[model samples]
Target chain A: MTQTLGITVDNISVTYSNSRLALYNASCYVQPGSITALVGPNGGGKSTLFKSIMGFLEPNQGQVDISGLPIHKAQKKQLVAYVPQADEVDWNFPVSVWDVVMMGRYGYMNLFRIPSSKDRRLVKESLTRVDMMDFKDRQIGELSGGQKKRAFLARALAQEAKIMLLDEPFTGVDVKTEKAIIDLLLQLKDSGHTILISTHDLASISTFCDRVILLNQTILASGKTEAVFTEENLAMTFGGIPTIRNEERGTRNKEEKISTIGFD
Target chain B: MILDWITEPLQYGFMVKALWVSAFVGIVCAVLSCYITLKGWSLMGDAVSHAVVPGVVVAYALGIPFAVGAFLFGFGATVAIGYVKENTRLKEDAVIGVVFTGFFAFGLVLSTKIPSNIDLFHILFGNVLGISQEDIIQTLIAGFITLLVILLRRKDLLLFCFDPNHAKAIGLNTKFMYYTLLLVLALTIVTALQTAGIILVVAMLVTPGATAYLLSDRFERMLAISVGTSLLSSILGVYSSYYLDAPTGACIVVLLTLLFIAAMIFAPKYGLLRRSHSTIESN
Candidate 1:
């Protein structure tokens, strides 16, 4: 197998143009070929970290790299793919699902962005993988919330990038769609793709994610899911965990051999 | 009578020139309008279009190329808007509204103060009927370049407009895309100013695209439909202006507005008529 490309964020800090400090000396390493959940509350700098890793927002303090390469260089090599939050998209855009999925192959396409035969095949395969082939020609805005997330997931899949960053993929999706997405991420992990997903859905973390990063403008904890997803870390990240523990009581799995993180 | 309605305007030299210039300008404006409209930058288009008036007045005073002055000032207005939006708590629409009106008022003041035979009425409303050969050349060049750039960079620009974060993550220079879009918008306004003037140019840039948006579900189709609406309106507006003895710019804008209203009501899937029909049937 080719050398696995993992994400490394080193002491990065981000401050928005509005003088709001979004991240402060934050650092973490996503192991190659693993699923890492960045669990944080709303406005906890998860999106900021994703943007920093994607080279969209330059850090005020430090650097981010993918597989020991500078972020921009990694991006040019098509080493990363990102699925932005639904709120970041203009749903009323005129592009069809096929058009949006086809954008994933743009890095491989030439200046005019005419798709090659391979590009076309990959787009079709990725859409079919996400079960969105039936809606390929439909306008993107016509899809359900879950379907829109799947369409964007299909876009990320089509990029064939080594590292995938998804921001709040579970926010608006149904339970079944969420399971399907998690299963897909597992398949990607097994294939040596490094994946980082930021979400507030704590219940699913222990089931499939190999690692968890508890964050609230800074890293509260970072390690294997069982070791780092403790109640104390959760409380620190969420500013008190009474509601989380109450919800966790109802959904604790029957097989308690492995420590499970749940707060639904 | 139909044949004369078509051929009568073709006989005049100025009419033929106006037709060619407006056709070229219409296509450019229509194409760029799709990006402007979809990106929710209609107010940005308004800001830039109005901001060019001062540049044109100054260009006339300095005997420089109108495009240069117009682009500089139009681009300056966008910069000013960006600066204010970044620094202030005010929203984007408010910033755009403030800056454009300020630039336009400055131009109005300057035009009144400047000692020249420049027709303030023509600057405000356009003089397509009295267009010069030099203006035709300038319009064609600006329109051609704008069209070519958009054609080549269509996908990147589309991605940037639709989801800039995704565009950035995929290694596209989104900052470049942003600036390039603004630059093209300024150029499009310059091409449109000669045909539609300061006040009506924003309408020319908005109506065709919005009409096509109502009529089509896909981007490529949207482009084709907008270009069709614009080309037809330009030809018909110029021809009807000859017979009706009206200002050509107002005639073009009126026709485009009428077409937009028609599309809003009568478009196949998204039209108000179809929506109402579907509601009635469901009941």
Candidate 2:
């Protein structure tokens, strides 16, 4: 089993270059070998938190440590992987699915980035895992939204990182793709991978994720999903009243709540 | 007759030097252009190439090598654009426009004020046929380094251009990659100045990659096609200039534009004609 690494963000504050305080003393701890859903409204510093944890930007206040190591050391050890949002990349870029997936092995390769047989095997295996091997040679722009998401997921999987951060993985994907992604996340959890995902899919959070972090610039509420995913907490996180739906209330009510809550 | 057409240009020493230097510049520009087009930095290329004018003029005034002044100004333009865009609310395109044109105008003003032998017409349009031996040496060395850097860092650069966030997550220093790309862009613009000049160099940096983009769906293939298109156009452009009694730089850019037009209409998958035909077939 892979040794999953926990993420510890210690009261980090991130201010943008324009002097906008995006995240303010926000802190969250994601346990090892668990799935955490980071739920928040737009402009709520979910991205800021992710950036801080990934060391993409230095936190103005505190530190981010992965397991026992600093963020940069964890990164150097390839212990973390990030699947960016669909809008973060230019799909019209001239790389095929195979080429994008092969990038996962670049850190392991030498300066020229020639993929060894092992790297190729890992790429093929990850693509097959995501059921995207059939579209390996196709350009990224030709893929459906779901397939693009899967291709990026396959890239993260190929990285063999113990800690995975997915920024809004469910947005703009079809239901089938969403289901596949959930299943893959579950499997990753079972294999002892620590996963943190920021998403607006509130109902599904209780379904698959073990823990939930409701955030608005700072950590509002965080604990087991059943405990932290309350109506009041949702209201605070989304800055609006949210009607909680029991599992027995059916997906229709849950979906209605998702729409009415305005987190989407 | 065909043999004469091919051999006629080779007989002249200047034409031979022009052919060699232009071809070398074409390869480097084409390679970087793949990244430039895909990264949507076409305007940035235009900005840097134009911004190098003041640098060249200063080099002439101070009796320094043109490459040094050109590189400093090209690099300074990019830095200024970045700084202004970061500090202000203006969009990147606006920043680029403001900075590059200012530098270019400053160069023109300086040229008029300084009593140097620098010809503004030649600097703007290029004088590839009359390139000095020292300029040829500078261009070749600079181009070689730029080509080597692009080749060695191709994968990282591709990732950086495609999805910087993903590149960052994978422990890549995206900032370093960003500056490395800028450095190469500056170097490439400096080298291309000899063959294409300040104004036409952006065409050398853009058209080939764009044409290849329309023709191929793969990055590697895009690169190959860009190189092939650029090299063919360079060789043909030099020969056509010989026959037409035209500027070598203008001929090269015209050829590149023509090839781009041909690809836009005739490329297999993404061509306008192909799409129209497909729609007709479906209808």
Candidate No. with top DockQ: 2
Cα lDDT over the full model 1: 0.89
For each candidate, report its DockQ versus the true two-chain complex. 0.57, 0.60
The lowest-lDDT stretch of 10 consecutive residues in candidate 1 chain A is A255-264
lDDT of 2 by residue, B1-283 (tens): 9999999889999999999889999999999999999888999999999899889989998999999999999999999999999889887889999999999999899889988999899899989999999999889888989999998999888888888877777787888999999999999988899899888999999999999999998888999999999999999999999999999999999999999999999999999999999999999
Give the range of the ten consecutive residues with the poorest summed lDDT in model 2 chain B.
Answer: B164-173
Query: Distance (Å) between predicted and true CA of A38, model 2?
Result: 1.2
lDDT of 2: 0.90
Over A1-264, each residue of candidate 2 has an lDDT whose tens digit, in order, gives 233489888999988877899998787789999999999989999988988899888888999889778887788788999998888778888889998898888878887888999999999999999999999999999999899999999999899999999999999998888999999999999999999999998868888999999889899989999999988788777766445434434566667766655854
Candidate 1 lDDT at B112 equals 82
Query: Residue B160's C-alpha lDDT in candidate 1?
Result: 87
Which pairs in model 2 have colliding backbones? Answer: none
State the lDDT of candidate 1 residue by residue for B1-283, as single tens digits: 8897788888889999899888888889999999998888888998998998888889888988778888899999999999999889898889999999999999989988877567878878888889877877777777888988998998889888888877777787888999989999999988888889988999989999999999998988999999999999999999889889999999999999999999999999999999999999999
- Estimate how well candidate 2 is docked, as a DockQ score: 0.60
